[model samples]
Target: MPARILFIDDDPAGREVALFNLRKAGHEVTSAADGREGLAAFAAAPFDLVITDLKMPGIPGMEVLRKVRAHSPEVPVLVITAFGNVETAVAAMREGAYDFIGKPFHREQLLLSVGKALERRRLAAEVRDLRVRASGVGREIVCASDAMRRLLTIADRVAATDATVLITGESGTGKEVIARRIHVRSPRAEGPFVAVNCAAIPGELLESELFGHARGAFTGAVRDRAGRFRQASGGTLFLDEVAEIPAALQGKLLRALQEKTVDAVGADAPVPVDARIVAATNRDLPERIRAGAFREDLYYRLNVVDLHVPPLRERPADVAPLARRFISELAPGREIAVPPEVTAELERRPWPGNVRELRNACERMVVLCRGDAVSLEELPPLPRAAGERGGEEAQDWPPLPAEGFSLVDLEKRVIERALRLTGGNITQAAAYLRIPRHILVYRLEKYGIRRDG
Candidate 1:
């Protein structure tokens, strides 16, 4: 496939020669006079491949390669070294250059390297697409709202690095989907993605489940098990509901993360493991930490980069798109339309269960709709009833005191009630009150509300 290429060299003759050959081979080539100019062009626009001279006037090729990789790790960079400078070219490769060519190289050799680099890029894209497709219903992320779009932009940027990510959101918000997306987009895409639900496993078995167990280690250990960490070798290990990990195991988990090694049950020595950590939770870790349920050190270890997925009720723009996608996926082989009224209704309701609830509602619509298109009546009755109940509550507020009522007192009481209902979680309390979190924080400060735990 043809691609956009950037060729940078201080030598005018060399730059022109490479530019002419790359353009002649059907690629759109951008020529940069030096490393600084080349980096500027790269930052300004997108390019599939970058060819930079190793020895430049102001900025050297090594620094350019490092900057390009830091900016976009997936884009391949080819280093151009002077003849007999093979060692420097190899060093460039170590710094993440795709491949290098000698100063007085053959056109065919340069073209071959460019073709291979582009081909690799193409294959990586295909792999990501295939992975998303293969992951069945409820596994895909639909970012129709600006909030979700911004979150995904951050996710993509972080996916380029090997940072430990902690995803926080209400349950059923597709944290696992985000983790899988990161794994597929990272350099470790080809490796296995091992996911372990920390909440589901019992405390007694959780350690073994995470770090494996040697044969005869326990009653059920008939065979040696290579736990989730080992299974995710060279890839990502997603620790779902990480906040649920027992306090006793938090120190061990912290050690494992810090040391990059695991000591299996009944194992004499610690085994080094290579797996990127990505954890998720719906619980409030800070509250838990203050309450003595979660350890602060372990929390820091898992929360190197935080990504918060907004609830469906907060990102109403996603409701229609997500519902449509779920309907299509659930009702495959049929042309089912989601009518405008149904879409409007979906956007209006508060999806307390987030994406999972919307998907379930879509499945119901797909299975129960009588006509080709969905009708408002086909929506799940419970969600509709919930919406109606909410509306009714809003309309049917308690009668005000007969004489005089203090609006300030009522507002303070309501905010306190919201905080109590959400267990003092500012974010959830704000969502419950249908207000921005900052606004809620301001109210808390104004009222002198004790928000800590």
Candidate 2:
């Protein structure tokens, strides 16, 4: 197929040759006097391939290669170098140039390289499309609330471009689901959809996990690993709990977003990445920035297109439909009936844990309910069980000891009980107490309690 090609060379003779040959071959060619002019043209529009000379005034071919790779890694770049500078051309290839031709190259040779590059691009696109179809990553979003519908419509509109998007919401509000919908409707639907939960990984390991590592770069580095950025090339990368990214790595992350490249650990070059970033976080990033936990500049870079997913309680109109959807998904072939009363009860409860809690409740109802229909009795207890344990029917509190109990000792005992109930899992214990894991760890150390006990 004919392709759009950008040719950049300082020499007038080189430009004439490229334009004459490439245009004659039925390919649309844009010629630039130098690398600077070439880069400007590239930024103005899209091109299938870039051909430039290694030596140029104002900006060199290698710099052009880096910029082009950073802007669009999928576009193949071919470098023309001096006969003795084949080493430099090879280095350019390592930096993501598709191929290189030495000085005084024949027209046939250039055309051949261009043809091969375009063919490779076509094959790669086909593979991505096949992978997307096989994985079925394009999930159907279920929502009934006007707020949600508006949000999704806006999301779909933004999906057409390469803008960065930041999704903000309470945990379990399905921010990732919205991100997936954007990917599915996007021009890059055929490409990979890579997701990284920043909070799940430790601070020290996250850098290597994101930027990759050369073999033996660290103690456990047994092999060279392609980082998330590279792995998501020509696709979308969803970074969940983006606020959890450490402050030290924030600068590097900002640079990656800015330059569209990543510096792998112990690697010589910054690998260009073409992945669209869609980050989500439950925490208020502005508050974190005020408290010095997150970088301000990085937040601005991520917030180019901000999307806020309202909590389940805020969108009560959607509760019934969501519950029904969950029931159908969980029950599969079985015809499960969710009565109006049961749905009313579900909508009445303030779902603090949001959609996730509702899904769990639906699952429980499906598993415990008799026959095909659900009853009011099968519904989960109301949030906080206030009706059961409060008001006039509340039981009396335990009497204080004659000498009074030690408050510190009481706190310690509560922490130990939480740890025991969770089988000595800090994360679970913290969740049970509705506190951060770090705070729980601090309490464990302050009280001298064993973590596994």
Candidate 3:
């Protein structure tokens, strides 16, 4: 429940009834005999939520809502109205009233309205917080592709609060890297970051690693020790491979997340700790949840913010820039040249490992191709997804893909090829396809094409 609710109504009976019901619902309630009193009360103290009747004397309900919205956009304003006041309620929404309850509303209706209103206010605050964090100092995850940019935009909003983040990508897709990005971009950046791999820790020791243990808690315990949560106090806790969390430990984990406190093994007291949670997993959590291996509630809590990193095969356009960037730093005398054909072949092959795989390719090229130039012969195995034009866009290719080839996997390969041919130039690719830059970008992102060198 919110800390306080202010009720405004001209009728003494209505005002008294609203105040009584709200107070009974466990809210600290204050009644206003009129809109003027409501506005005055609003000016004097902080209120989590405000409920006002539409037809009020002195200032009027609409005016009161306007002033409240202007002064405190984060606070929720709920308007109450008669049966035929639907139009007025619609206007109130435009004027920034969070929600409405009719005069003859049932007990649940009133309570639900207030609850939803408070929730809206909470979301607003969280969005604001995320905005601030998103603007924090760090090299932005730079990418010209619309999909990646869109994901980052969503990430900014997700980083604002303690909402659990679930980053999904194939192996080497940089999931953990993005998780750290969120952590550092969050308000809890100053807090310690403790990363736990559900897959790395032995199942038997998983619980101990997460929640800690009391002295003599187990045979191996020589002394009591603080756990990851305590270690990550006032910071963010990242759980990689979250889908691997065991069923037995899942319930305890859910409880700890809900309560923001942990009870170590063999300990009677629950120790409170403040830590923002950011969880990452490569597995399909929804599938795991359906298989009964993962708790549904815990999955929902952790999936509040989800980011899926497209495979290296999908974002081929990122390959070349990343590769050149990777190779340039390693190359002596400052400049390393990228051969167009090598990049073409790089774009042709499906990179199962995403960015991590591309980085390895660049490193290999740097080591093997000692000269400033790298050729297709020195590149890794290539895919035939690109080089299939003929105005068909996709079809007219040979039947039966070679070993490790998939028809369903052409998007990233083709986009990567187009980007490489276009010389890391987005406008050139759009021109080649005779499509708008935005549309081309959309296609590149949709296919997950990262340029390769």
Candidate 4:
């Protein structure tokens, strides 16, 4: 089939010859005098393939290749190098160039390379589409709040482009869920959706886990294996808790994002990757950057489009619908009604754990309810709010009972409540209680409170 091609060369004569031959071969071709003009032409419209000379005046071919791969990895890039630069051609391939041809190439050679590259891309797209159809992964975003609706609208709009996205919110605010929604709505919906929790993996082994490792790279490395980058090729890669990525490996991650290539541990050559990055984090990345923990350049690369998920407390309207959805999920075949009082109590309580906590509460009610309707008694105890007295309003502070509470006991309870509200994030919990993070850690240890609780 004839393809739409972008031909870029600094030499006017060389470009004319290639353009003439491509048009004669029944292809729609656009000509650019240099790399910058070629990129601008590509941005204006989509093309099937890109052909550029290795050396150019404005932007070098190698730099252009990296930019192309970073922005649209699906597009195949063919480099036109000098006659004796086979080594440079191989290096370009490592940097995600599809193929390289020497200068003074024949018309047939150009046509053959173009044909094969397009065919490979078509086959890959077909396989991806088939896999997505077979999986049938679907989830409805049950939301009634205006904040949530606006967020969804933004997500849908960004999903059409290939820009990297950064999702930020407190823990348990359903960041991963939002990431998945974007992926499902995107043009790459048919591609694989691979997720990795950066915090879940230890810092020492995170590099290998993300970029893969060859055989005998480490103690447990018995055989060569592809990592999340390769596994998510032609798709999306969700890096949950991305703020937790160690500082030492930040540079490598930045390089991979810039070059669209990953060097596996113990591998001689870097592998090309086409996965779109959608990173999520509960921690404040700007703070981390100020503290010298994260790379600012990488932050800019990943934050091409930022999506912030509002907490459950901020979007009270979504509570009832989310509860109803969870109830249906927990009791698939059975019909169960949540009483008005139970839902009222759910909304009244400050949900520190956000959507995740609400889902857990619904599960508990379903398992414990003996009748068709769920009541207030079936609901779990709500987390205690700081500075509250028993059965009294906010104005009635420190309303001690006839049997007064112990000072230590009260402190422990307050600490636990703060921890619960922040989803066990010590730094956030301390800020909520107007204390230092170290103090919160000490109290947690003193009271035997588990961080994961």
Q: In candidate 3, which residue ranges exceed 4 Å CA deviation?
A: 1-142, 332-334, 382-453
Question: lDDT of each model, Cα atoms only?
Answer: 0.84, 0.86, 0.76, 0.86
lDDT of 4 at 98: 90
**Model 4, 15-77: lDDT tens per residue?**
888998889989999999998998899889988889989899979899889988887788899
Question: For model 2, how does the per-residue alpha-carbon lDDT over 1-453 read when each residue is reduced to its tens digit?
Answer: 789999999989877987899999999999999999999999998899999998999999999999999878788999999888868988999999999987888999999999999998889778766776677877777899999999999999999788999999987788999999889777788788999988767788889989999999889899999999999998899998899898999999999999999999988889899999999988889999999999999999999999999998899999999988999999989999888888888888877667877887788789897798988878766534324555543564333578888888877877886665554556557778997655677788888998534
What C-alpha lDDT, on a 0 to 100 scale, does residue 393 get in candidate 4? Answer: 54
Highest-scoring model, TM-score: 1
**Candidate 4: lDDT over CA atoms?**
0.86
Which window of ten consecutive residues has the lowest lDDT sum in model 1? Answer: 381-390
Instruction: Assess candidate 1 and give its lDDT.
Output: 0.84
In model 2, residue pairs whose N, Cα or C atoms come closer than 3 Å (at least 3 residues apart or on different chains), thus clashing, are none
Write candidate 1's Cα lDDT for 35-149 as tens digits. Answer: 8899999989989999899899999989999999988887999898988887897888889888988878788998999999999989978877676456431245777899999
Alpha-carbon RMSD, each predicted model: 11.8, 9.6, 17.3, 9.9
Local lDDT at 45 for model 1: 90
The true-structure Cα RMSD of candidate 4 reads 9.9
State every prediction's TM-score relative to the real structure.
0.68, 0.63, 0.55, 0.62
lDDT of 2: 0.86
Sort by TM-score, best first: what order? Answer: 1, 2, 4, 3
Indicate which candidate wins on lDDT: 2
**What lDDT score is found at residue 202 in candidate 4?**
69
